[model samples]
Target: MPQYKLIYFKTTGVSEFVRYLFSYADQDFEDVRHDITTWSKFKPETPYGVLPILEIDGKTYHQSLAIGRYLAKEFNLTGSNTLEDLEIDSMVDTINDYRILFSQYLWETNEDTRAKQKEQLVQEKIPFYLTRFENRVKANGGYFFGAKLTWADLFFVSLKPYVDFTIGFDTLKNHVALAEHAKKINAIPNIKKWLDTRPTECCIQEFLDAKHKD
Candidate 1:
């Protein structure tokens, strides 16, 4: 096995899906988390000065989704064929599109602007995307792609907490299929163990608060 070290901030943001992939695969990795103070010192050393980088046997690679795709393939969480792979990738990217909208609201400095973004996110964007996602999962018989669990399912489930926090409520409330899908993923033994034991700090929230104060 290659020596794997995952470098990211101290919160389960973009890095959480990769962490889930590791847990689901039962792969041991060095999860290196940084705070604002430490990140400043370490930023220059990264390949792109952005995080969620995975060091595989001392060769570091960047990009969260790319790393996820690689790991999913390695762990057999990917689709069986090219067409299935396309569907899985499409679903993951669609989820990412919605996640980016929430991120914009989270980091917005202007209160009025943030309020508007939040309204649009909560009232329009969230429902629009999640309704489609709910129907997708329902159509696929409780999974995102085919008859079995794929990385697309893991990706959505892993990001649920962050999305829920941004929405100030359970984003899955009206989406029954999505709620059940999350339950199914969380029920996995390894994934459950990881969730139960992972770090508890809301580092992203703290960082945003500090930023606004500054």
Candidate 2:
């Protein structure tokens, strides 16, 4: 088996994308979870002071996006040329910006404060970004930026809870185009089969379920 390992906390929002990528590509990987104490002990092995690191072929890699790009190449999910890859990179970057402000820092604010943040994100940011991407999807006539099913498309389709866990709020369910975009990407036969057979992802689905509960 190819030795693909990812060290991460129990949360899935960050790690889940890569896991989904690997699984969809039918790549076998080891996902090791670390609590804070375990992470402190493991830090020396990390190139940086980060919990999420990927190891392949006894070589370690850092930076979440870099890992994504690496896996994209391995699976042939990145675009063909430099410009195409740049466009894919651009879309992923925008989503990352939202994640840094919202998902990563979500629980830090009080409920009332977070509600206002959520309102702004849902009312303005969500529609604006999704609509822009929808236009891009229309432009590409199928995919996000590369005129094909790139890793960036998978990344966005997997991102359903950036603003709010509720499909209506975070995902803009009213926007049929964006919804269809997500559905079409995920519903690809190979992806759907792989998803059904794959082991449960620890953090991502759990978080979505938990959000629905609260």
Candidate 3:
């Protein structure tokens, strides 16, 4: 196996998917996390000056989803064929769309605007996305795409904490299938091990607290 190094912030954030992909494959990797205070010092050395860069052997690659797709393909987590790959990619992209929506609400500069956006996110966006995902999970017999686990499952599992923190509630509570799907993924031996030992800080909370004070 080639050497894998992932550089991102101390929080789960975008890099969490990459971590989960590795964990699911039982592949060892170097997870390099940078605290906010020290990021500037390390920023210039990054190719795109961004978090969530993956280094294979010695070459670095940028873009979170791009890295995820590559790793999914590498580990056979994508799917067995082209059509399945398309479904998996579509689900991943849809999840990422919600991620961007949450980011906007989390980091909004205007208090009123943030408040409004948060309300919409919690009331409208969360339900819309989670309900659809819940249906998908139920339809797939607990997984997102097929009879077995895929990168889409890992991606959704990695988003649970952020979803809860941003919505200020257990968004999965009313969605039994989705909740069970998350539980099932988390129960996977390797993914469970990673989750048990990973950092405990709630990055979403810290991010909001910092933004609120500014």
Which of the numbered candidates is closest to the native, going by highest TM-score?
A: 1
Q: Give the per-residue lDDT digits (tens) of candidate 2, residues 1-214.
A: 6699887866555666787788778778887886545666877877777757898877888888889988898899887888878978888888777566566335433667777776776678767777777788888867777567888888877656434543234365666777788888779776687557655434444444445556
**Tens digits of lDDT, candidate 1, 190-213:** 999999999887678767877988
Q: What is the lDDT of residue 46 in candidate 1?
A: 89
| Best-performing candidate as measured by lDDT | 1
Which residue segments of model 3 deviate by more than 4 Å?
202-214
**All candidates' TM-scores?**
0.97, 0.79, 0.93
Clashing pairs in 1: none
Residue 201 C-alpha lDDT in model 1: 75
**Candidate 1 all-Cα RMSD:** 1.1
Order of models, best TM-score first: 1, 3, 2
Whole-model lDDT per candidate: 0.90, 0.72, 0.85
Residue 2, candidate 2: C-alpha displacement in angstroms = 4.3
State the lDDT at 210 in candidate 2: 47
**Between the candidate structures 1 and 3, which one is better when assessed by lDDT?**
1
Worst 10 residues of 3 by lDDT: 201-210
TM-score (C-alpha, index-matched) for candidate 2: 0.79
Residue 141 miss distance in model 1 (angstroms): 0.9
